[model samples]
Target: MWANLALSPLHVAAGTSVGNGALLGLTRLVSLKLAELRITDGDCAGIAALTRLTELDLRNSRVGDAGVQGLSRLTSLQCLDLTWTQASSPPALSSLTKLNMDNCKVGGEVALRVLRSTRFPKLHAVHMSMVQVDETGRELLNAICSDSASTLDSFMLPSASISTVRFIGRAVALRSLDLTGVKITDSSWGTLAMLVSLQELELRGTNASNEVIKSLQDLVQLQRLSLRQTRINDGALPLLQSLQGGLTSLDLSDNDIQGEPALQQAWGNLQLLESLQLLKTKVTDAGAHSLKQLGASLRELHIGSTDLSNACFLRACEKLQILHLDGCRKLTAPVFQSGVRHLQELQALTVSDCPFISKAAVLEVQKDLPLRYMSCDDEVLFSAKKTEPIWKSGAALTDRLQELAPYDERCRYSTDELLSARYSEFVPQLESSGPLAAVLRELELVSTQ
Candidate 1:
């Protein structure tokens, strides 16, 4: 009966061959999941016929090389999760924007060659955690700095990768870079400074400090900079003035940043700043008071686990939208209720692990504000909506989504595979020259003289 209609996301994990026959006519299936499923050689192989599938999750499934070979032609495929599979050769994923191949195979040599920026030109996030690379010298870096360096917005490699790419300095067209959990080599500091067009740079959980800050002074065009959980201290705060004119979002969370004279002196320079994250830093009441100066433009803020007892700073940011107040022992209920009512734009609020906030106080504040989502001391993070399917709840999901689509073997290598297999004909224009960059650059060139 469900076969006549266009079906949605389907999951077939740890199930017998009962409903597999009724899953054939679902040509509009957008997402499919088979993670940790007990399947044989040709069990769910018929899923290769779903041409419109944009996302697929085969993580932890024992589906070997043959199973993934069918997915290589999914041109509309934007995201793929092949975390714990035995597939050696990466299928030619032409339109992939995000990929997770964690612990697939060590020394990902063959995978590196296929990881060319031109191949997956739209590739944004690549997770190679727990996988070691055999590429020495500049092989790993050069593969990333290919012809399509412009379209690759983000390259999140949170693994033990240490290499100095000499060509990265020349790739000025490439700006948005994420080197999370990868230690920056001493020699690479000079190379990083050459990217003057860098608007978004994230060095979260790395070994970056003032020494690296000196090289980044030339990044006046930088807008979004995240240095969360690094070795940055107050000494580097002075250099922030160089990029303050253009920077909108700045994060110095979990660092040794002491908020006092240094916070007011250096931070007061940022007049156009928007979102700020100072979670778990050494910011005191003096630093907390200074934030009101930036309240006009500041929209999102995360100041959890600080030594500030006062919640009066929340009264200033009338334009504030999202806020996180987790692990703040000093925040009392009366103080929070009085301060939060000022924020008319507040939508998302997180107050987890605050021993001072009572449930009665939370409901009282809810009356005055229009908070869409709240997370604190509850199993359910959001509301009781159950908006999206829980992918990991294998058997439970399969029972609810029984009539997704019928499986078939005849159309596995259909005409859709032939078309999406080829690489893009033209190299996409660099995002740096895109519309948003043009608008931002125009704003930076605004003069006060």
Candidate 2:
């Protein structure tokens, strides 16, 4: 029920109790969200009074067709989200610029009827994820695409078929396209590659082939492309090499591109890549070395659940800001000594599941070079949980160690003097022992002093 006297975004979710009087009073409200609530058709009636409302989100609400009818009076509304809600039948919303009706109970026919009736000259974005569509729904979608293809900038649909995808291609003005759950194969790639204006394209879980994917090299304007969980391989990557200079973000995570040869080929290019994700992929130390080429341009990098060892971190990626080495089992103390210590620009580092790294070592490194966020496997300073009986007893052992007595007066001498004195004291005692033993004992004595 909180809002300023002027226009602002108001979000109220999780079935929070909001009275009608408070909702009706926000006449100047620009955006109002009432998601996951008990709001019904009657509650929506109060919203009709907010004539200036430009954005409304009623996702996961109990609103039905009647509630949608009540919102028809909101002439100034531009963006409306009815995701995971019972509301299906929408009124003619000519002013809407963005509409999201994902996972709604309504059939595509009713939704399309509303869409077909509405004139969205300025509408640019629409997301209908997980919504079932019939043949009639497909026709309506085609008709809607035909109507708004010139103006639409973004469109995301989960169950797009090849025909529906080709129809969507008519949206020449589109800059972003997300077809995550679509069944489009190599046949549809030709139609998709025609979207030369696309800046961001996501084909996650698609059946796109390497040859079909490389055809998108014509999209020189493309910046962010995600082929995660696709059929693309190493050979197909070189086709995408045309985009190496302009592409800023690439997500090839969760693919079958195994070994260093394939990974090396992928990383050999892309000098301007700012973010890269290679989680759950098989890559060895040799492949990890390929990342050194990116160096300063690489800002955010994730290499989780890989076969990379400490040698992977030897690369001088000095400008790296965020690094994720989660589930890299071979990584150990050398990660801190040889790799992390040198990355001066690192802000956040995640080393979870790296069993060889200890919490104490991480704390010491952080003390030397402070970081904004640091994550490890366990809550304690050590990677593994403490199993010692004393630790289980939960005594004030750590506090006692912090309050231990100072060094002896004789130990106040310089480190070099202490080492020289300790060598003199322990050298004769270990003279009969091997030279290695004598040297070890002398070093231990110096350390104790």
Candidate 3:
């Protein structure tokens, strides 16, 4: 086992305890991760001989300050993760460029001392989520932001307060910031706008002021923004529209946006936008109509849970590649024959839960195009609730349905001659099955059976 100690990466067992026999032979490993292991202070002494180690992760481990000290001898270590551990004091890691101490029970003073004394000139990213940040920690953060703003560009500081956010804004060089589930209000918008270099920002499950969108206007370089499950409403749409030119991806899913009039007015203005998600929004046919402006540019569009009819897809999304129309209850067969089938660029389509659509229409489109994926389950069962079978009796209709039922069970429509000869056997059944009532009754029975 000791013969291969010079390997580039070494992974040990999760249950491995301190002074385990397997670890005795490994000393020349370049990267070591003892995450979620029973390793303690004494075990770290065995790993101290791996001077070539460049990465170490002791996350969720029982390692304490003594174990941390033992591993600190690795002068070449550049990345260290002590997440969810009890390591109170971290040694001065001059060579470390990335450090994650999220959810650790470390005190503010110890963290401050490390941050102040640590001399990682190349340090570019840090994650301090759920870490207790006292006044000293805040000062330490401000010092890092002011002194090393140029080198540091990415930060993940979820649960951070407004003061911490203010301090972070001083790092003008930041290109990415993740404050998901963080608590901050509109008051911090001005401070946040200082990150002029941010290219990607994630604020999912976080709430900020409507004025926060005003702050985002200065982020001309921002290409991607995720506001999923946020409290922003229709009034904030105009502010979001300011990022039309440079922004390519925007996620407004689970928001209370009833309409997108600002986006409708600026339809073609967002020429660079490639992906837009409006899932679970209160968008209706009007909202879908406004999306026509993006049909030529957007590669992926999600309008699920919106109240749209077949008319929405008639605009012809010439460049659209993926479309999601789930829970669009108003859609029917006309959407397929008139609108959707014409989208030659469409590679994937989802229309689940649209009870007005027919399995036949979905199948026709599937056969016409080489669609990579198509979901149209729960289609309409009948032309309507009333009307009698054009056929003589209920028994005759049941026999015909019994024959078509086999293939229809797998899909909404039959793929064999039964459906292929719709003009002959199928239409006649619909015409005889009252084109509505009787045929649907049999279909319901077959499905239930």
Return the TM-score for candidate 2, rounded to 2 decimals.
Answer: 0.71
- Cα TM-score per model: 0.63, 0.71, 0.74
For candidate 3, the lDDT comes to 0.64
- Stretches off by above 4 angstroms in model 1 are 1-82, 87-100, 106-127, 136-141, 161-176, 196-199, 266-269, 372-449
Q: Which consecutive 10 residues in model 2 have the weakest lDDT in total?
A: 399-408
Which parts of model 3 are misplaced by more than 4 Å? 1-5, 16-25, 88-90, 129-147, 160-164, 310-314, 357-361, 376-449
The clash count of every prediction, one per candidate, is 5, 1, 6
RMSD of each: 12.6, 17.8, 15.9
Best by TM-score: 3
| Residue 253 Cα positional deviation in candidate 3, in Å, after optimal superposition | 1.1
lDDT of 3 by residue, 60-175 (tens): 77777777866668899888877767776555666767777767554466667677676555568877666666666667666667666787888876654434377777788899
Error of 1 at 442 (Å): 28
lDDT of 2 by residue, 1-449 (tens): 34447757777746589768878768789888786678788888888878889988787678887788678899999988787677664457778788776665444555666755665566688776666666655665565567777888988775544334767767778898877757763365677666778888877777766866666766777777778778876565566665532777877777765435545464444677887777666667766776777786888777755577755443568888766666677777766557888777876666667778776666666754446556566343322111211121111221112111111123223333333433322222211112233233433432221
Better of 1 and 2 by lDDT: 2
